[model samples]
Target chain A: MLEAAGTPQEIEGRSLWRDARIRLFRNKAAVGSMIILGIITLMAIFAPMLSPFEYDQIDWGYIQEGPNWENGHIFGTDGNGRDLFIRILYGARVSLAVGLLATSVSLVIGVTYGAVAGYFGGKIDTIMMRFVDVLYSLPFMFFVIMLMVVFGRNIFLIFIALGAVEWLTMARIVRGQTLSIRRREFIEAAHATGVSNFKIIFRHVIPNVLGPVIVYMTLTIPQVILTESFLSFLGLGVQEPLTSWGVLISEGAKVIEASTWMLIYPATFLALTLFCFNFIGDGLRDALDPKDR
Target chain B: MNAIGKKKAVPILSVRDLKVHFTLSGTGLFGKERKLKAVDGINFDLFPGETLGIVGESGCGKSTLGRAILQLIPPTDGQVIWLGRDIVGAPHSAMQPLRRDLQIIFQDPLASLNPRMTIGEIIAEPLVTHKADLGKEEIKARVKRMMARVGLLPQMINRYPHEFSGGQCQRIGIARAMILEPKLIICDEPVSALDVSIQAQIVNLLQELQREFDLSLIFISHDLSIVRHICHRILVLYLGNVMELADRDSIYAAPKHPYTKALISAVPIPDPEIERNKERIVLTGDLPSPTNPPSGCVFRTRCPFAKDVCATDIPTVDTINDHHQVACHFHERM
Candidate 1:
């Protein structure tokens, strides 16, 4: 028999989450994106303190001005004479909030629904998954519009509307993952121990499925952000004085031929944020893959 | 305990005509419904402190039998009477307390321990669940004691299962199962996945633990030699049906069933001369598909002494002696 190694191997303690974090940091692109994302978040929180003018403050004399160093409007002014820089900064707060809040709502609902359906796995699974299938066939945008019309054009309601629609795919992903995880021997061992089904789903099943869920979350954030942009572009999201990146870009599009900086600034930030999210999502997928180890 | 005294003691567990048939998905919408009789109408009794070895080929339902007995998977039909209570149809709430008394060890040790949990947490789970009143200090003390008892170092408690070797992982699995001090533990090929040298170590650890706890074990394995080392009663299964069941001494000394004889002959003798001289009775074909087993007797198609009558009627188990039973039509002449 092999004796316990004389050296007692130095790797005596390490967790999957810890190791995954290490791997994630090692990817230069992921780290770079993380830094960019951090900077964007800070700028969004400190926008009011940092900007010289309020996002809605209009200087009628400086209307449609372009990149003037003298007046300190670095990126220039919009058609409404509002400082474009502050508008883009304020827009980020709404866009990021919508992305994060809606995605989180979807996360909780998806993981719970999927874990229950997958772990119990019988007539319950059949019924629950079929329900997801039915929802999948509905026109999601139309449903969101209906919700907006019924509930009024509140921004928080938009969070719920998008979250309620987006969770279908998350449920499908988590359910597929949970279906395989429920068959694993640890799950069987948990069942043998008489751990209540609810406890087992959360403790054993959900933790095992988190790798996929997390990777999918990064990807889903960008999708949620884009969906919010689409809603705002359609004039249904974040009304007038409260600006979003989508609202700025839509406002900029009208004067793209006359003045280019209006469309250029907000669109650049939106594209950069979306690109960073995709990079981080790709990095997480590779890092969490068991085959990589 | 004397053999006679042990026989007179009330059985700790009794399985009566347990059937676990799974319906297979049909190929086409109109394809006929098919049943795979994974564990077809099997019965056995387990006594306290005795290791009942269930030996069979792969796909012969040995694992299914173990799971069915523990009610991990609901059996299709029959009774799993534990201490006189029929648990076959027991509700999950009713089965919770019973699960504390009946535990299980699995085939793959690493796969059986959750990768996300520390070894300490994995072993303490049963205590936290069933012995909810146990204080943190008490739970830690018990977990540390169990880790040492299974030959794992107490200091290694915080590590995840992936950091351990296969043998050490199996030790963790053993520690987890034994922590609850269960009355019965169904070991489903616990050592089959380990190296030969490691297999002996695990088997010895299990035996030592069994003696200390007076554990009643349903030791399932396809390896006959390993089963011979730890099992008190030997049950030879073929295609989900019992071919022979007898005490180790009787079954090894004089196997009555033809299937039992063939299985015993396959065990390679240690001595060179005896190994060279012994005759081997290798079965001719692969195990018949459970979905379409041979008519009447499941094993008739593979039996060396098969006859027309063997194909027409299922053979009932015949009592050769008080301690031995053979399920074959012509066991007397065999």
Candidate 2:
């Protein structure tokens, strides 16, 4: 309409993703959490290597000592003679892995399963959703204990079990999302173009539903970590020599009166990490919508 | 890419008694089920390069008819004869080849486009799906070309649909529909969602594209004024039934059916003198629920001069002159 419409160089194109990312960075709490998470993750990886005492190494010199610099045990030794700092670092690796990998496993399974069920409505949707409902009714911890009993306490199996259990909710969320998305005009437009149903589900349906799926995924990671911790408390998680925050916390909780630092250190790390994830989740939910989701 | 051959004798699209009925199941245990006849037995023939306007009220099934013809919503019965082949019950594989020649432009311009996809990907989707052998460069070139043709700047091809205004989004929709160079495009109220100023631009763009590509269009809308611009012939539908079908000028000047007359009268003239003096025949009462539509004639309940006979026997379409058909019992007397 106007000849002086902004020149190509003047008119910069901004994608929704770039805008969301910019907004996400602008949130002070989310940015602070991200920086803290990055620092913690880096410390978790490198801090253990720099420590003089091995995570499992027992020093008969400083047994049940309070946090004192004379011993070079900054976080102090536990009821055992091992350094608390190195063990917490080791715990960080296990907990973060369980959180991320388990959540990824669930995301893959849930997104595909839900998208297929919702796209192919009618009998297929009913049967698939009913199956999900059946899974939902199962006792989560009881079956998880059973898997541990049968599989001999493999940490990988814990991931699979937690992921499998966690995906029921993800599948339900994705299915509900897909149900609404399939009726959207874009999906019909895809059909009008003669795109195969298979292509439609993967390309058109899944990508649009990913916003909610991603928000749900951020929240699910913390839940998965907490579950792993609970399992460890029950003595079914990572075995001896390989410790997690859960293992550290359970060990520390028993002798809290004699040594409160052991409980406080792991508990602080756990709470801070979980809060970071929750805050990040809230920021993403806001940023993704940008129009007040 | 389209090779235009004007076949005056044979129609490009022949929708013969096409009906798309939906059965709504009961909500509770004792709730009664009912049939909603959205598009009940509509007949029309669209010749090559001609524009057929379908104007009706909100629930008169204008959209259902457009989707039915494109097989977007599969028809319940009757034939959608395209190029001498009935596509009503055609399988997906069989329809894929035919889809290249048939396309539709949706009403909500922004909603019709995938938010995740760029304008280039959205417009190139049909080409990528139908033309399997096209290289990436070739497809991109074709997409850009189509974009330019639809009055969109080629530089904006990579932008998302949300980045564009309603008029620009409709242009993107048109580029997508026209990229395959389809023979017939069912524009399902394509401009209804745009601003009034933008509506004229979109309509003009559509007309320009139609002329250049030799495209036949079945333009459907609830607004009769918008349909009057580009349509060669116009059809009047009341409650999924065609009340009248005639040339655009005849329907506007001397409408035979009362429903058509009311619709025509509702269209405001631009001049203040003519608009103020025009006798507007405003129909009372809302469109009846399609589940329990009137038995004999769908329009009889709403008709101003409805004789007792209008409610007993259904009025079949009567041919008044060359291709001018009216479905009213008192058309001759009126």
Candidate 3:
């Protein structure tokens, strides 16, 4: 079938992947979100270098100070006199880290579990899905609380807990996607070639199902970030010294009357980060979608 | 009928009493487990470098038989000897090396090629997976060569599958299958999804490639005319059982089995005058489900010529000539 498409030399004129990327870029909202996301990611990475005030540094003199542009406290100080701008910048590091890291962990576990269950089918699929259903029935807050109680409130534990819970939805999505993709001719063709089951699942099967997986992963990041923020708001996340956006929001909400700036700064940053991630995920959902092509 | 002259050379692939049964839980309230015999005791031999066509109506176990031979689906009981190796029950790990020799072309070309992957990547995947020793440049060169062989533009290697038409997609599918130089290719209705003109093109291409590669083909299709054009030998299956097996000419000119005869008569000839005059032998009743097939002969329920004896015992292949075999009680009278 490859021969009829014309020669490799002829294929050099234009590539499909490039064309897809071009079409994706033309989606102004997606592209714009991607750029903003890229900038935010860079800022998060260079938080230490960019922030003059250490995340833990406190100044009693500048307590509850509003955005003072000349003094270089661009977003002003929190109730603890910590630079809100610097804290939020550093807070991005933790929020993005937890979101990305947890999502990655979920993706690996989810895609593998889903592919195997969907590909093998029959009894294996039923059993795996039933397990997922059991997990799904458990309340999200209860599950997280149970994990925190069992594993303690370390950063790693938070990542593990969020990832473990998030994978259920991802597994369901991946399994559904795999069910449809496994029925495709290429998979059968791969089977006919005597390709190893492992290779078939990982190489051929996973790549085809990556579209939905990627879209789900994008959406999943926000969910994880929100969950982490909620946990931190309830005083169970990030501990005292190492603060996340959730920690900042939690602290800010306590001093809303005396220092509205504290509440507004962290809340705006949190909302913006969530909006950016959602926009990026939505863009990717459309871009990577085979139906759109 | 000179059976002695051809008896010495063993067929490249032989399937003996192949049965692929799926245990389906009853949909009713009871949820009783019932064995659905998808491929029921089918037997055939594929000669080296011969295109053995399996022609049957939909849900007649033709595709199931193809998959069973490849060990894509585990057979309940059977011996699929490919060059003396029983592949029916062979473990997937043990069957890995044998995969390079056996490949398949699927019916839906569009669905067969991965949409996300470029044509080049899709074709190179098998080579990369199996032949790991080959370097990047060598793989690219081989992919380009294989692409050329399938009549695809080599430059279009970077193009995704959706960019191509149905014929183009089928070509890509053919390229992927033939890239590794597999000896036995199971073409599961490869051209049935294509237009009439494209079907002829694909069939011709398959025939040319088969001769060039000296490959044996298990061509599965419901299109009798297309099967007649490509296959050297034909196997007629009905309700997961072999109804007839013969050389193409013998099957077309003189089909002994009533089922085979009915199937052939149903094919509409291109010529209007002959097509109008031709008597169509439409079989009575729907196809019996493989879950609970009729006793004795599976075709007895629908066979117009069936008698009491026909429903009592399963008909074995009765040799009509050196290469022609039919599974019908009245073959002698026919």
Candidate 4:
């Protein structure tokens, strides 16, 4: 689209990555979602510092009370008399951190493993992919619980556990991408130029597969967040004082009739965050479309 | 044999009995593994500075032969002798140095270039791979020079392949191949993906560069018109086997093999009167599956003059003269 020969306006030619970046910024919904997501992430980070009361501290004076500006418990108190607003912020921290960190873990493990298998192909491909298929067949939650039990329930354990599961899909996605990409002319051209096999896999094969990898990454974040929430809902995730969106929502559910405001706030934040991520993912898919160019 | 005394220059590359067969094993149990002999027993000798055009229809293993020669697709059997050294099964590391001498220019100009890379990076990749000691500044300067030679503006070095026109993209592909100053370049239908108007320009550029580099070229294409213009000699392939090899003038003026005759007949003459008046040898029947090709001569099934001998015995390549060869059981009579 950036024809350099005749156009006077053209100074520097736009690389596909740069063009994609420009397109992403131009998409209003994606831009707005990024802004909103940034705000929520910031809010989650500063929740402890911003909130006047501790997340777990009970205000006996306003026990099970509705939101009131007088006490600064705007989102009101839970059945335990803890401040709802600060608890939601703390939950945001756990939820967002799980989404981002777990995806990063999967991205690292999945891309490298998948690129190696796909680029080498033949017997190596069969062996590696079958190994992935075996991992895929294992019961998802059982694997997570086993990891959690063995690792002593640390939050970092959750990151690895979710990542371990999500990476199977990631590996598959990247493998399928590179299977086609390896046969692409550019890759063959790379080989013809005598680029080492490892170099080709890491350089040519991996970067070309990034478009799909990134799209899957955005999808995986929300999926990980939801799974973490489900684990928390079952009371198996993030122990006592530490709270997540899932934990808050699950707690809010038990006291729904008595404290409706408690459920409303965290659920709104969780839904809004998921919505924003989906929009951003859609924007990315469109932006990175080679066909569109 | 009519003989004459002459000084013979040693061939730079000789491919003897080079075969590339792929066995496609079935997915399920008791699946039969079928042998697809893509380029079976191809033989040719390329002299320095000579352009050998390989012309064949689709699925004739023209591209396969080129790749097999380069060792990109390892040949299942036979010898690819490069300067008297057999390199058919050479290890990747051992072949790294050989790759510098045997570069390839691929069809589909845009696809051959890595889209993520800029024009500068794409052209510089071969230099970076082969010449590890060359400094980045020197590489960049060499790349800029090559771009100028290939007719691409050096200022557009940072632009991606998608940003360039098809013809321009092809120049970039050529620049990549020419950068290393390889002795031989196997151009696998390099201009097939370009515009008809642009094909001649690319072809002319290749010829100009060939003279500059003293390069032996294996120019493969389905287009005979373009091939005749640039190639010193032409080899016609039919179903993974050579049908004829002759000098450009002889092959065009007097084709001995039926398949070559048919192929040349299909080429439209530039003059309208000659084009309309010329006989077009339109052959019937689809190309037989390579898995189970017709026995003896592969072209016999559709050969207009096929005899019982053509079916029972394979026709070996026979020399008509020092520079011409043909494979037909009845060539002497025909």
Best by DockQ: 2
lDDT of 2 by residue, B91-154 (tens): 9999999999999999999999999888888999999999989999999889977877888878
Q: Which portions of model 1 show Cα errors greater than 4 Å?
A: A1-12, A290-293, B1-5
DockQ of each: 0.51, 0.55, 0.50, 0.51
Give the range of the ten consecutive residues with the poorest summed lDDT in model 4 chain B: B1-10
For model 3, residues B1-334, the per-residue Cα lDDT tens digits are 2223333568889999899989887888998899998888888888778888999899999998988888888889979999987876777678888899999999989888876678888999889878999999999889988888888877777788878999989988999998899999999999988899999999999989988998889999999988988888899999898989898888899989888889889998889999999988899889998888998888999988899988899888788877898888888776
Candidate 1, A165-190: lDDT as tens digits:
77888898889999998889998998
> Local distance difference test, per candidate?
0.90, 0.89, 0.85, 0.89
Model 4 residue pairs with clashes:
none
- Per-residue lDDT for B1-334 in model 4, tens only? 0111111677889999989999988768998889999998989888888889999899999999998998889899999999889998998878988888888888998889888888888999999998989999999989988988988778788888989999999999999999999999999999998889899899989989988988889999999999988988899999999999988888999999999989999988889999999998888898899999999999988889998988889999999998889999878775
B1-334: candidate 1 lDDT, tens digit per residue: 3433577788999999999999998889898889999998888888998899999899999999999998888999999999999999899889999998898999999999999999999999999999999999899889988987889887777899999999999999999999999999999999989999999999999889888998899999988898888988989898889889898888988999888888899998899999999988888888999999898778888889999989899999888887899999889888
* Worst 10 contiguous positions by lDDT, candidate 1 chain B: B1-10
Model 3 CA deviation exceeding 4 Å by range: A1-10, A13-20, A42-57, A70-74, A122-153, A290-293, B1-8
DockQ-better candidate, 1 vs 3: 1
DockQ of candidate 2 against the true complex: 0.55
